[model samples]
Target: MQRDKAYVIKHYKKSLDWINNLRGLSEEQWRTPIAPGKWSVAEVIGHLPPWDMFVLNHRIPFLLTDERLPKGPDVAHLNTMAAKKSREQAMEETLNDFISTRRQLLQTIQQWTNEQWQHSFKIGQSEMTIIDYFVGLINHDLHHFSQIQNVIHV
Candidate 1:
């Protein structure tokens, strides 16, 4: 199997598992602040859309066709900018959008050829193999999920 695809698919399953586990949450719980000076659960979930759109659509194709990365829209500040919209959204809508968007992203990833798994990309000024990029995304999910869980029943 392609190494990057295998690793990313594995973790995407885990990400789905994590989201499924949250099926019991109350709306209030989903809206609870997940981190200090950071996103609420809904906002963090909302953040997935653009990243998935970027990676599965733009980055992979761009790297394969021209070997270039997105050069603008400071990613470090992205969550902050996006969280503003989340704050105005209904929790259920945001969660549904996250699940729907991620499912589409996983589907796109599954279509990639073996060479695409080795595609080089840059995320926030860091260089990475496609495998590393997917791993990092999985790790990012875990990190934020932990924050959500910590705030869930408290």
Candidate 2:
């Protein structure tokens, strides 16, 4: 993939449209579970913001620095924490946080130089570019969106 600004912006725009589809869902719909052991639509939606915040605060900054990047955060643990926090929040509030944090991340990304987008962040013995990192996040959003759609339609 090219992994350019336009590509990243496309994903960001698509995310907003996808999220808009969740608006106005009934309280019951929002609370619907994906499967027997899975998180509800609300909790899945709530899980996204902090990861974006992490991208903005920790991942991106560490990558921008010339210093060696540390190991990635424990995503499973973060998700567990985020899901628990979301479980107590209203659907509207969680959705709003998702929208706000995503937009903020997008805005921050929009200002980056091409070099920054192409900059490689070391992970273990390998490296991944900033744009690649964002693509992973986009996939993460889509994964949750699909989960929400499946549960909502059931």
The alpha-carbon RMSD values of the candidates against the true structure, listed in the order shown, are 3.1, 2.0
**Runs in model 2 with CA error above 4 Å?**
none
Q: How well does candidate 2 match the true structure in TM-score terms?
A: 0.89
Identify the leading candidate in terms of lDDT. 2
* C-alpha lDDT of all candidate models, in order: 0.73, 0.81
TM-score of each: 0.80, 0.89
lDDT by residue (tens digit), candidate 1, 1-154: 4446777887776677677667677878777777677677878877876677777666766655545676645686776766777778876666666777788878878888878778776657777777777777778887887788788852
Cα RMSD for predicted model 2: 2.0
Q: Global lDDT for candidate 2?
A: 0.81
Tens-digit per-residue lDDT, 35-140, candidate 2:
8887888888888899888878877778777787656679899999989988998877888898899899888888898888888777677678887877777777
TM-score top scorer: 2
